[model samples]
Each structure stands twice: as structure tokens, then as C-alpha cells.
Target: MAQVLEFKLPDLGEGLTEAEIVRWLVNVGDVVAVDQPVVEVETAKAMVDVPCPYAGVVTARFGEEGSELPVGAPLITVAVGADASGGSSEGSGNVLVGYGTSEAPARRRRVRQAQPAARNGRAEPREVPAAPAAPETPAAPEPARPSDGPVPVISPLVRRLARENGLDLRELTGSGPDGLILRADVEYALRAAAAQHRTAAPAPAPVARPVVGGETRTPLKGVRGAVADKLSRSRSEIPDATCWVDADATELMRARTAMNAAGGPKISLLALLARICTAALARFPELNSTVDQEAREVVRFGHVHLGFAAQTERGLVVPVVRDAHARDAESLTAEFARLTESARTGTLTPAELTGGTFTLNNYGVFGVDGSTPIINHPEAAMLGVGRIIPKPWVHEGELAVRQVVQLSLTFDHRVCDGGTAGGFLRYVADCVEQPAVLLRTL
Candidate 1:
């Protein structure tokens, strides 16, 4: 006999409670091997491939693509034992949080039938009612009402979209199974509302009314949602302050050019800036620490886990470089390139996306001069670098055009005061203005 085993979604770690099914690799009746990836899911952090711990024929699948399922929800059911297409009865030893073969089999729950009341002190056999026969015509579903309680919305992005547009999700009909509201349904409702608004408005004679369309709404889920949640939390919880300085980056640019000209592996400008940041953090260790809200104590870090913000098609992601203080410009350049590629391909792991003492955001690529960046939560500070452009400056008491860049430091006020923040920014600006200033720390 084949023993049907259910495989529930495993914890992806980093406090992720749920994940949306991006695609299913296996279907019903498909033979799968142990530890084989059965589905690809997108969590707030990153895209993950969920592996099945059992090797057997897939009997059923739980959710459809794009449907969000909480951790421990059944993902698929597999049939084990020789009768199940000659599959093995033993499950693979590979372990995930909720799925493993080492644990004892779970006991099935049994339901007891209701007994008839005693009649005249003697038990009388009650007549059992027959099950209702299926009607020839299926009845129509009941109309959704305002008192239907809360709408079934799994994605926070969908809820936010409806809330921002003043659209009541309960009034709209969802195209998903079981009336599960999705981002697309919210967008469609918005478009319909806009069309209705335009039609109701009176138009002046001899004036052409422009058609309102072509609005593209990308759902803030996966990596984008993760970024949004982190930034929002950082703004709400942390007492953050920003300090910026315009530095003559001509020296830094020149130094980078020289290094690349004589280097075995070409160093990147971002890597050079990262090197400067790590050196600055060493001098001002206060900016490289986080506050323990529960303990109400400032937790200082001995090593630097530098996170750099990388923009991708999926959204903005900060991939951390582990022990960045120990890595040189060449090594940092290589690591940054690798991580950036991973971000682009959406292959970065949860480990790469977290555990940073500080962040370096190079928003200069967007062609902006400067921005007061929000600090990455739990991290004390973030160094924002702006575009390096030609600007008039006094060099050696003579007016000259130099490559200048703006450096902004956003620090947590709870961790350090303005004096400490100013000192850190000044050190970084000095390094940018004079690359030789970094040599002292090196």
C-alpha cells in the first residue's frame, strides 16, 4: 500500500512568514527525486527554489502560481511505498524546518459520530438521514456583501494599492480562486474608476479631451516590498539625521585611473568608495554600530559588514559584502561585481541580503547630485554618494574646474550625536578630496 505523505512549505528563514508561488516545477503524477526542487517561490527577500524531501510520485499540488501560502501550508502531497509506481517508502533524510524524514509519522485524527438520546431509559436506534443528492443545475454563487468581513488579500502590496487609490477591495470581484484579491484586480478597478470619473466630468466645447491611459503599475512585492518595509520601519523607528558635504573628487578619480592603469584586476569606482567608507568607519566606530532597542544599549561592532545598494529590474536590493573592512579595493571590486550580477539575475541568497553593520548607497548612477538616504534598519548609518561632475573650485588658490561629488551620511541619532556623524562625513569627504588621506588608515 502506498502511504500518502504531505509536504508543507518550509521556513525560508530571516523571519519570512510566507512566500508566493512563482512557478511549479513538478505537477501531479510526476516522478520526483529526493531533494529536487519542486517549486520556485518569491518571498519578500529573494527568489527561492523549494526542494521536496520525499522521492515519490506527486499526487496533488496545493496552490497555483502567484498564490501566497504561509509557512507550514501544504505544498504538495507525495505517495510513497512500492505500490506508488515502484517508489521507495523511506523519505530522504534532507532536512528543512517543517519537512524531514527523521521525525515520527504523525497520527491521523478521528472524528466520532453523534449518538441518539436515550428514550424511556432504553437506547433507541436512530434513522440516519441520506446525503443530499447533487442538483442537476449548480446554484449561482451568492453576491458579495459589505458585511462579508475582510477581503481575502494575501499581498501587502495589493492592500496598499487599494488603500492608496481609495478603492474598497470588498466591493470588487477578484479573478483569483476563492475570491483572493490580487494586485492586478486592484489596478483594473483603478482604471475603471478613472474612466468613470472622466465620463462623468463635463467637457468644454471646441476643446479636445486627452485620453487617460498608459499607466503601468508594478506590484511592490518580493525584493521591492522587502526594501519598502525596511525603509518604512527605519524611518518610523529610528531618529535619523542627515549630513552632506560636497568634496572635490578629482583626486579620487585620478587615483582610480592610476590604479586601473597599473593593476592586474581593474578596480571599480564604487569599490574605491567602499574602501574609503570602511576606512572612515574604522576611525569613527560609533557610526558602524546598531542600537539594541530591547536592551536599550548601543551594540558596537568589531568588523564591518558593508552593504551596497544595487538597483535591479526586480527593484532596489542591498547586497552585503561580508568583512568588507578586511577586503582591499581589488577584492571589493570583484565581490561587488559578483553580487551585482546576482542581483540582476535575481539569484542573491537571503544571507547576502542581510547582516550589515553599515550601508554605502551610490545613487550617483541615477545622475543625481545628492540625496538624504534613509538608514538601513539595525544598521547605524548609510553613506550616499552622488554623481561626480565637473564643478568650479579653488585649487591651489586658483579657480579651476574639478570633478566633484557630494557625500551624505544618514546616521541614527540614538547611536551617536551630530558631532560623531559630522566627523565621519568629514573623514570620507577628505578621502574623496585627497585620496592620500586614506593611506594613513590603510
Candidate 2:
């Protein structure tokens, strides 16, 4: 006999609580392998392919596409025995953080007393003793009473919605398969209650307002929402200051041209700027640190995890290059290229989007001159590079048309004073004006 093992949505890491279903890769009757990606979901940070840990024939799916499901909610149920398919099913070692299956998942199971929050959407999480697993039976279209059985709730988010509005779960019947109460049912119930209340009391007069058309309102969710929240938090929390300078980038441009002309692999200007930033960070380690508000301590990082801003159709995302200080210019170029392509394709993982010690914002690609970049939260500084355009400047007491660029440094005031910030900027400018200076650190 096939035991229907329910696979809850495994927790996608990086503090993400919920994800909207973007697409389902498998149907109800489709056969899934262990660790095979079964669904694609969009969290606040990035789009993730959620893989199922159990290998079996998928019997049921929980949520529809385009709907948001909280972490730990039932994602799918797989019949995991020889009868499920020609071959028996087992657990995969490769599983996400929150949930996983042990060996012999088909015969025995651990009843995870997952608080409704993750599965149901509850505050406290506790573990219960393992029990002999049983096959899930099709439930009738009725609410289960308190003494009868567990509440027929599909998502913890629905439970929370009904809870916040003071709706009783046992009073209303479930509408989903297996008597699963869905968000729509709770919302409809709340709306009906609100209408009855309004009927009992006189409603307020409708406020008149001019209707405006041709305005598109896009919901701030996913990457855009994440960016907005982080930027807002940065602005509200960090005491930031911006310092800028114009530098002759002719030498830096020439050096890059020379390196590419004689190179096995072409180097990128962003990579060169990143190299300079790492050097400057080494000179001023305070700029490569984060301020811990609670500890009231400034945490300095030993190595650089360089984050660069890449604008994609999804919005602005900063893809990180880990251990950037250890990477050469050629390696940085390749990593940056790979990450940028991932960002464009919306395939950059959450890990690729976080843990940045210092950010290099090359807004030059947009044909802009300079910008006081908002520091990515938790990180203490950002180095902005502008377009290198031809400008007439004094070259050894003589006016000449040279490739000039504007560099701006935005630093957290709590981390360091203006002297340190200025010194760091000056070092970077000096490197652009004189590429030979970078060789000292190299």
C-alpha cells in the first residue's frame, strides 16, 4: 500500500517567510524524483525553484499558481511506496533548512508539530513524538469540530487572517480539497460579516474625489518590495554622508585597454573599479564594516564580499561577489558577468543577493555623471562611479581633453568620520588618475 507522504513547503532561507507561486513544474499525477525542483516561487529576495524531498507519484497539490503560500504549508502529497510507481520512493539528503525526510520516509514519519505560522502560520514551534504514518483520506465538505479532529486549514496565513478578524475556524466550513479552509473562504466570510455590521449601523457618506485614469499602479512586491524596504530602512536607520570628487580616468581607461589588448580574457571596467575599492577598503577598514545598533559596536569584516548594483526588468538587484578581495581582475570580471546574467534572467539566488560588505554602484552605464547612492542596509559604505566622458582638464599645467569621471562615496557616519571617508575616496581617485598606484597594494 502507498503511504501518502505530505510534503510541506520547505523553508527557503534568508529569513523569507512566504513565497508566491510563480509556476508549477509538475501536475497532480506527475512522477517526481528526490531533490527534483517541483515548483518555482518568487520570494521578496529572489525567484527560487523549490525541490521536493520525496521521490514518488504526486497525488495532490495545495495552492494554485499566482497565490502566496506561507512557509511550512502543505505543497504536495506524494504516494511513496512500490505501489505508487514501479519503484519504491525514499528521502533525499539534499533538502532545505526547515523540513526534510529521514531514511525510510515511506514506512515511518516524524509528526512535525509545526506551528500554524509556518504550516498554519503560529508563533511558537514545538516538536511532537513520531507516530505511525497513515495515508491521507479525502475529507468531506464540512468543518471538523474541536473534539472531532484537527482544523481543516490549508495555510497558516488563512488562519492568521481569520484570527486577526476574530473569526472562528470551527464555525465555518472549508472549501478546498480534503476540507482545507482557504484564504478566499476566510476573506469572503469577513466581507459578509462587515456587510452585516454596516447594515446594522448607518454607513458614512461617500467621499467625492476626482477619478484619474492613465495611472498604472504596480504592487510593490518581490524584488522591488525588498529593495524598497531595505532602502527605506537604510535611510531611516543609517546616519549617512556623501563625498564626491572628479578624477581623470584616462590612465585607468588606458590601462584597461592595454590589459585587454594583451590579455587572454578581457577585463571589465567595473572589475577594475571593484579592485580599487577593495584596495581603498584595505586602507580604510572602517568603511568595510557594519554598525551593530544593539551591541553599539562597529563590526569590521576581514574579507570583502563586493556587491554591485545591476538594474533588471524585475528591478534593481545587487549581486554579490564573495571573497572579492582574493579574486583577481580577470576573475572578478567573469564572476560579475555571471551574476549580471543571472540577475537579468531572474535566476540569481538569495545567497547571491546578500552578505555584501561593501557595494560598488557603477551607475555610469546609464550615462549619468554621479549620484549619492543609498547605502545597502547593514553595509557601511557604497562607492559610486560615473561615466568616463571626455572633458577638458589641466594636464601638467596645460589644458587637455581627458577621460574624466566623478566618484562618490556614501558612508555611515557612525562607522567613521569625514577624514577616513575622504582618505578612502582620495585613494580611489589617485588610482584612477595613476593606475600604477594600485600596483603598490597588488
Question: lDDT for every model?
Answer: 0.79, 0.81
Instruction: Predict model 1's lDDT versus the native.
Output: 0.79
Clashes of each: 0, 7
210 Cα displacement, candidate 1 (Å): 13
lDDT of 2 by residue, 1-442 (tens): 5566777777777877888886677766677777877886778777666788777667667776667888878777776665444455666757553334444443554333333343322223344553333444322225534634346776444554676577877778888997788878898999998888789986663234234553446788777889999999999999999999999999999999999999599999999999999998999999999999999999999999999999986789999999999999999999999998888767787788889999999999999999999999999999999999999999999999999999999999999999999999999999999999999999
Which candidate comes out best when scored by lDDT?
A: 2
Residue 88 CA displacement from its true place in model 1, Å: 4.3
Cα-based TM-score, every candidate: 0.74, 0.75
Cα RMSD, each candidate: 12.0, 11.8
For candidate 2, the 10 contiguous residues with the lowest summed lDDT are 114-123
Off by over 4 Å in 2: 95-214
